[model samples]
Target: MAPEPYTIPITVRGYETDSQGHLNQAVYLQYAEHARWTYLQHGGIRQSDLLDKGIGPVALEVTVRYLRELRAGDETEVDCRFVWGEGKTFRIEQQIRRTDGTVAAEVTGVGGLLDLQARKLVADPREYFRALADDPAVFGL
Candidate 1:
């Protein structure tokens, strides 16, 4: 079958919920983070490689729109898509869905590559993204 439009498997923890009885808004950000990392791995950049290479990514901006409340013990899958941008800045749109396949939230992020040592934007890792954009599967191929 062709790749699904989005597929990221993740579990919700009890601590993820707040006194409000639903997931805290911050937790959704955490999920977006987890989804982003998973997406990178699926796209070909491993965290080990980033750490070893002294190259990492940083989020310039993040916007999340919560559509429904997610509770503890819930399992969800995220659907993500790449949005192109200049230089090290790129965008990814992610939709979080409950086990029943209903949307729980939407996350949009503007992120960029960073040279961890200099604490500044770098162009090297962007090449990784550029290559990934061409054919994500090929990274593992």
Candidate 2:
């Protein structure tokens, strides 16, 4: 279930910085999440489609490992890869890298397919993702 690697080049905006002159930890998650969304959109999962489907994907767990400090003006990119999961979950592993190819941080988020109304995990993950994976209108499927 590996989607193509997505590179998100970012300019460290002032709002994303802290008084410490570096990006705040929360901003890292935000950046990674954006990268994930960008990958999904590129793959063909549009927000309108999701809304029409009456389903939602929510993160059930995450692991964030910071390897180095990034300061303002550092050109960086986040590479994202989607992986298989157990049950109704999908796992995405991502690495935020510097222009020199140094790993700045690693993040993994486990997202569960949910029934929008009941707010419960879907019973069949394969069928659900397959629908998305199959509909070229919905995915690179």
Candidate 3:
């Protein structure tokens, strides 16, 4: 079987919903961001550590497609996976699914490494991030 995408459970809160009683579209990105952080942590890299090295990951673009509605108090899972791109750029695919396994939303994000010191994108990142970019199994090779 192929490797499973990284998943994290999230509970919808009242503050995350809009007047329509459904989760706000903007909140969906927050969920995906959390899952991305957790995924990176699982891979032994932390945002703080990256910042300390004067390098950070930055999202170039993010597209979110809302499917089913998610109301407050609903339990959901966010699944995330990394897709390799040219050089240090890569894509992350995330989905928010209801407890019943129905997809609530899908988020596709493009990102790349940044050199904090130089204040620009880096074509060649350090070994830690480079490893993730080069690993085919990370995206389920």
Per-candidate local distance difference test = 0.75, 0.77, 0.83
Model 3 Cα displacement at 42 (Å)? 1.5
Error of 2 at 15 (Å): 2.4
lDDT of 2 by residue, 1-141 (tens): 433577879877777788998888898999898988887676667666666788877888989999988888889999787676556777778999899999989999888777898888887655665666534333323
Two-way lDDT contest, 2 vs 3, winner: 3
Residue 38 CA displacement from its true place in model 1, Å: 1.6
lDDT of 1 by residue, 1-141 (tens): 234444678788888789977988998888878877777776666787677767777888889998998888889997776665556677778899998989999999887778889998776444666454435543222
Where is model 2 poorest over a 10-residue stretch in terms of lDDT?
132-141
lDDT of 3 by residue, 60-98 (tens): 999999999999999999999877655767778889999
User: Which one is best on lDDT?
Assistant: 3
lDDT of 2 at 22: 84
Query: What's model 2's TM-score?
Result: 0.87
The TM-score measured for candidate 1 stands at 0.79
Off by over 4 Å in 1: 1-6, 130-141
Error of 1 at 31 (Å): 1.0
